[model samples]
Target: MLFRLSVIIVVMIALVLSSTWSVNVQAQGGDEPEECVEFIQQVLTDLGTNCAGGDPFQGCASHPVITLDIDEEETDAYTDDYLGLWPIAEDALEPEERAELDPRDRFPLLPAAQVDASRFDLANEEWGIAKLKVSLPHYPVAADQVEDTVFLAVGARIEDTTTPSDAYFPAAPIDISTTAETALREAPRANADVLDTAPSGVALAVDGISPDGEWARVLFTTNRLGIWDLAWVPTSVLDPTVDTSDLPEVEQDSRVPWQEIFLHDGYEESDECSLAPPSLLLLIGPDEDTAVEFWTNELYVKVRGATLFMIPPSGNVLMAYVAAGVLLVDPDTTDEWVIPAGFWGYWCLSEPDFYGGRVPPEPDEERERVIVPCADGAEFVRRLPDDDMQAWLAALLNPLGEEVPDIVETSGIGGPTIDLSFNNSDAIDPVRDACELGQLPPDICDLYEFPS
Candidate 1:
């Protein structure tokens, strides 16, 4: 009886182990789409890494690396294919000269040719980078073929940040609508008349105007968002073209010049203050869906500029996608147009200094020389490699009575955990330090439970 009981007990233990092994295998098994796998492989290849160590699933690493893949064929289409459609004399056409054509006749239409799909290689590339693959429809062409302008529709797939093991493809193509010369002539009429008046709450200033009076640039400040917006439009539509004979005698009231339009924080003005060049300025925003819905039939065009479209702020996924598109087309100057640091705020048109009075409190001293903790629990000490220790100490000590938290450590919890420690202590007063603290806002400290 004892021997029989031992045999049964051993069999039950074996079964339990087998079941556990099966569960693990299933967990590691990747059910992701084959195309997604190909894309990830391609990105890894581009980054000069092998797929073995980099696979999101079956790998030991916690965070998957992000990678971008450009559709070279599509990129080439934008660069080479679309350029072919430009009228040889497009640059030479005067505003009036181009305006003579029918509005429908002036639209830039894409060529009817099909793009070769094979040129987009998402798989079999070198490894170790996360992958993204974008497929886009052929450029749109007009039925009449009289207009040789091109419109492109692009689609993209990116690895999901929330579910790092999976990927997502855009349901719709991002549309790039081209403007006609006639439409350009009609842009200025849509401006708000109050734009000319500098009201108490909203400040408006005109910037550059096109020589033909077809376009005008303007800047406005919004109190709510606490930022300035600069926009360009056709002038004929903004205000009735000022008759030269009846023009105002005041110098500042005269047509705004592009060079003088940019606002500077101080008296010192330099070339850096200049706006981006005309060709390079593609005004995109208010978002993709908004742009399409509004522009499709609305009498007034609210959003105009290169590729302006709305996208969700999470992971800044859309911004990264648009940035990639812009980069692929204009490789040399792509970095200059990277998305600004703060773009999620609602855009408002108002006057300068509307929210200028609400500037956040200045940092307190002693907070300066401290080593702060980063998201990863790593210490970040800002030391000038070229300067002597005494110089650094002097800078840190000069501004006394400001609290600066210099050390950062992890909270020892899972999932985006972080903790801040000052000078290796569990509690320290930031204001007691000699240098001013910049990053740790009051609200953030309160949430993190930093000592008061």
Candidate 2:
């Protein structure tokens, strides 16, 4: 913010001190573009007084957006700052001047769409990477402050999130091969039931490594059902050339924990109302001695030089739209989980065990696990849905005053929210499991074919 302000200030100061300064400002043309010189002078002179009023926050808000015309003789001098569009000047002013001007009479800033295109780079272009920027300050430090105090972005939300139990990591699996034919254990231990023997050369996918680094949780087809499923194997049997150091650590029940970014579920807000951002991204810029954590969501992830997007806690899942650089996620008391820049990570809350096609845990011994481990877990796919994505992108890329796309309309009920729900079932793909699992509505589920 200061960088752009300094550039404009330098240009403004040079113009003011130069021989042409008086000719530009003293011109009696009130409505002419040259009058912008007068506007800038008034703004620069009053910046200190207006911004530093009794209540800085309220004081800054008192100054409304204003459009000032540049001196046509000097338009080329600072035209680039205007970006070929009218620049809305938001500077402090005297109480008398504030009451004289009707804010509505002034021109608006560049359309949010045009401005977003030039500024925001959500994880849209590449996979799993969005940058969360910051312009928030705890209090007013200077009167010449030109930074944005409203730290929220359009698609981001922040709310009071409770501290979740323990650390968790979603299943992030990739295909590999069994180094040698070995018996697949029902659990990571060698004495566990042998589900099957994986051939020495056959392909399999492993999602987790055991705490002791002695075993791995692998998913492969079994001879009985021939359906893709999960099993455990000794880590030594996995391809030695590949690295398992970064895979999520396995817990009991072959479950991968919901570790990274544990957020509260749903659009629910808390009565305490501390406002911990259920969705907004923050650039903490943490140092080695930094003390504050963003919110109480199990893990405290301090990232440097990378962007992470925390998704709205929906469908009982806490997700992060990943960024394109290597992000290190560290929990205070556990081994770190490394999410390669290309993959997204989330923590899904387990429901009553019956909901997940499994038996319930003992009341005193319940644990949080993914409902449908692989299906609900993240999968690396070759193709992403581009058409639907482009529709979402339209909101991100449209210029000011352009009609918004039919999708992603803001639902005004919750303060400035985006309606990301899918109303038309026509666009939904007929995932067979979604229909059989009762995830889709009956009418929509009936569109897909299922085996008798």
Best by lDDT: 2
TM-score of every model?
A: 0.22, 0.28
Give per-residue CA lDDT, model 1, range 1-452, as digits (tens).
11111111122112211212110011113333445444533332222221121211111100122122223233333343334333323432222121222111112222211111111223332112111111111111122221110111111111111110111111121111222221221224554333323322222234345345555544433321122333444443333433322211211122211101111111111122111000001122221111110111001122211221221211111111111011111111322121211011111112222211222233222111111222322211111112232232224223321122222233354644434333312113221110123223454445335332
**Global lDDT scores for all candidate models:** 0.22, 0.33
| Residue-wise C-alpha lDDT for candidate 2, range 1-452, written one tens digit per residue | 11111122222222212223211123222322343334434433333233231211121211223212222332233334333333234432221121223322222221111001011111221001011122211111123332222111212222221111222233346567877889987777779888788889887677677789888777655221112345788878777888666676765532111112222223222222111112223232221111112321443443321223443323333444322222334422244433322234655334523221223333213223221111122331112223433332332223212211122334366553322222222212222333444433454333223321
Query: Candidate 2, which ten residues in sequence have the lowest lDDT sum?
Result: 111-120
Model 2 TM-score relative to the real fold? 0.28
lDDT of 2: 0.33
Give the C-alpha miss distance for residue 335 in model 2, angstroms: 31
- Which ranges in model 2 have alpha carbons more than 4 Å from their true place? 1-176, 179-186, 191-197, 220-230, 239-427, 430-433, 436-442, 446-452
